[model samples]
Target: MKTNNNGKKSFVQRSLDWIEKVGNKLPHPVVIFIILSIITILVSEWVYRAGVSVEFFDAKANETTTINAISLFNSEGLYYIFQSAVSNFTGFAPMGTVLVTMLGVGVAEWSGLIGSALTKLILKVPNSLLTMVIVFAGIISNIASDAGYVVVVPLGAIMFAGARRHPIAGLAAAFAGVSGGFSANLMFGPTDALLSGITNVALNSSGNPYEVSINGNWYFLIVSTFVLTIVGTLITEKVVEPHLGAYHGDFNEHEASELSLKEEKGLKNAGIALLLSLVVAFLLMNPWFGPFQTIDPETGQKTLQPFMNSGLLFMVFLLFAVPGYVFGKTTGKIKDSNDFVESMIEAMRSMAGFIVMAFFASQLIAYFSHSNLGIILASKGADFLQNQNISGIPLILAFIIFSAFINLFIGSASAKWAILAPIFVPMFIAINLSPEMTQMAYRVADSSTNIISPLMNYFAMILVFMQRYDKKSGIGTLISTMLPYSIAFLIFWSVLLIIWYALNIPLGPGAPVQVSMIQPLIGLM
Candidate 1:
């Protein structure tokens, strides 16, 4: 029997040990993706043979659409397998974002700009407040796709090491906010646009005049940003850090050192370049004569929608590349344009393994989507809830739970909502619930489990980050370290949600809990 007695392993430790041993025994991530791809191919054929199909509302087409499992085990499937190989790798969205972002980030990192910044941050921010700030920054970082995992998570470790704290704990905190707190953010992003569009399609299919705004959950998310920051900090300090004990690794001592005169000069120039770049970006986006500016057809006012939509990615690349180049030149780390190019190449070298993993993962994801199994399972879950006689808070709670369960399997928030929204949005409308609330609930579920799900696109990248700090760190270690933050965030975030529901607060501008039940009461009133 396991006990807490001296020399006897406690139950939790034993459990973690078992998990680590078992997980480490599993296949490598690339091999695992290959295996899942095979499984998806075989299952598609089986399900198709079994005649499994689903009929659901098509919000986009404004009609009922039927889905059936398409067998990837057939001759046609073999052709697709061969034909789409390169396109699947190239078209995989996350793969492109990471690869491109790394080109600039790698240069910045290799130029010693990122390291010097971490040292400055360590000196400025209080150690007591460091974890909270990192976690908060992580949540905010999601505005730039993949920035949190690819940037903040590693920076957290470096900053923590500079502060003489446990680097793993710092990594855990950043991961918690970037992923586990993904549902909570102060601003709208691609996720907001994607999910809202899906939600609106569902609402359109329901024939409801009510439309969910992209900022529908804005206020709640604003609160969540702060709430999650506190909760994440508390969990990291109280649970994750104590469990990690102390970091005893041979870390880069230069990370904590005071920057030399040249280094400080480089940082200063980099900062100015970054700020000036932002000002130029604002002018290009906001001025009436600016190329990116557009006049609203209805309001006849200039808007930056074009820039916000199309320019953000380029902006992210410049944000890193421009400052990095200036810093490199200032510090003489980059003697020529070739030195700059070499730094970028070095960054790509680090990502060599991840790029391989992305290739296999793309194939697996493409196969899964082509097979229609993900949507089928999601629909089956929605159908189960619809058949239940549940309503009000209980139904909402049940949906939350089910969506969270669905999240364990499906990693894309937009994909999950595309299936869920068509069913739940209208059904909730008939019962006095708003589409905004439905969308909000789905967001909560979508984000709560991201850290623990191996299928999360960035999970492999984060695991690589973990190994850099702790050679013994495995999938199990990353999961276990993050599991507490996930649980705590799920619990408290849900509680905050419940409290918000009970108070009948406005979810955002013109978004309410009951949606006024206007359509239902129209004739009667």
Candidate 2:
């Protein structure tokens, strides 16, 4: 028994060392994206010249279609590459969202509103439930998009530090919930709309005339929210915290201080500001009088609508900015408008690396899309699966595993699903499985692997957060530390999904595991 235990320990240590070594040897993420962009351009040319084509069933077109690679090395491709470069960078989804949201969050953090609020809130919680609260908060924070990564994750570390526990454990738990449990939210957010929209496109493409609602997986995800919280708490307390032992780090002395009179006043003012902001937002979104309300062309009904499908981001901005500005004024952190502007500028400065990386990433993604490589690969993969004579639960499990493996390579969940949905949604439908079931499985796989994927957009940000305490922390340290959470989430979540499938639970409103009337197509099988 002792020998076996020693062997396990030795193996773990060696694996960690190797991961660290390999990760450390890699170029900076921005450079890596630039190299990838160049490679993609070359590959597009090569594939186009070689006449690589795939026969895919175009669901939207309701017919078979041949997809050919478009080479980016030609005159037309060169013009596109040059013309679209600036637009690509400017229009990158995360670029604008993060920048705009941070303008508000920056003021809050600079004004000490976030710190004070977090301290008071966390200090009130019993030590035993601290992990649970942090984890749960992180899970729910997905409603505000990437705010959790910026706010809740670091706050978890701070709260844990204040409680005299291993701060990294708190960080891990929060990260697990924020990224690993990203799809598991109690409320539907922008991600729901974004992913479901893509799924709908794929469904339409696959000749399915029905559109999936945004809340297709809401029920399953709500339950998953609690499951992740419970699992995150257990893993943090039992495995990660213990393995981390005690913290004798630079942040040990950074305990929470009692709220001062001015801070108290600031909090009061901030609360009032938040309430007012909410009221204003509510009015703006009201169907009867709201300026943002519009008529849906297809449905021909008046409706309160999101601003460019990004009402959540705008709402977050309002929630943070109003409270932050009030807090800053009340606490004398901002004596004038200059201070507020400075705060926003400082926040933008911090995101310089992300901006640089986004430029290259945008190019890479654009090139890849033009090349038709993603769709080709997805179609081939689906064809291979179809030929295997697999169906039912086993097929679902295999797909979940395949998605997880692919996640390690492709970081963006939406981008990956955009490619995979057209292939799998119809295939699954042909086999009598509901599109919702296929989507649910994909979500499970995507969220579970987020923490360990180096290509994840926020991965570098996570490292920077870790380095605040441990200067030696790097890509390997972050991955190794997070590996346990990833494994636990993947195993437990997959089990939950399988159980859900077996019990034939409704994934959401009108979403079922299998469709009764839809018989399997024997010819396709």
Top of the candidates by lDDT: 1
Each prediction's Cα lDDT score? 0.82, 0.79
State in Å the error of residue 351, model 1: 0.8
Model 2 alpha-carbon drift over 4 Å, by segment = 1-14, 57-65, 72-83, 164-171, 189-215, 239-249, 252-254, 302-305, 409-415, 460-472, 517-525
For residues 27-85, write the lDDT of model 1, one tens digit per residue.
77678789889988999999999999988876555567799889999998888898999
State in Å the error of residue 294, model 2: 2.6
**Model 1: colliding residue pairs:** none
User: Model 2: per-residue lDDT, tens digit, 1-525?
Assistant: 012344453454455556756765767656767887888888889888999888755544444568888889999889989999999778766666677788888899888898788778767888899999999999998886777887788778878887778777788889999999998999877788777877787766655666678888899999999998999899888667655556778554546678999999999999999999889887888778888788878569775544645666767877898899999999999999999999899888877766776777777777777777766666677667767888888999889888887787567787678667777887788877888889989999999999997557677667666766665666666787788788888889989988998899988998887874343332211
What TM-score would each prediction reach against the true structure?
0.91, 0.86
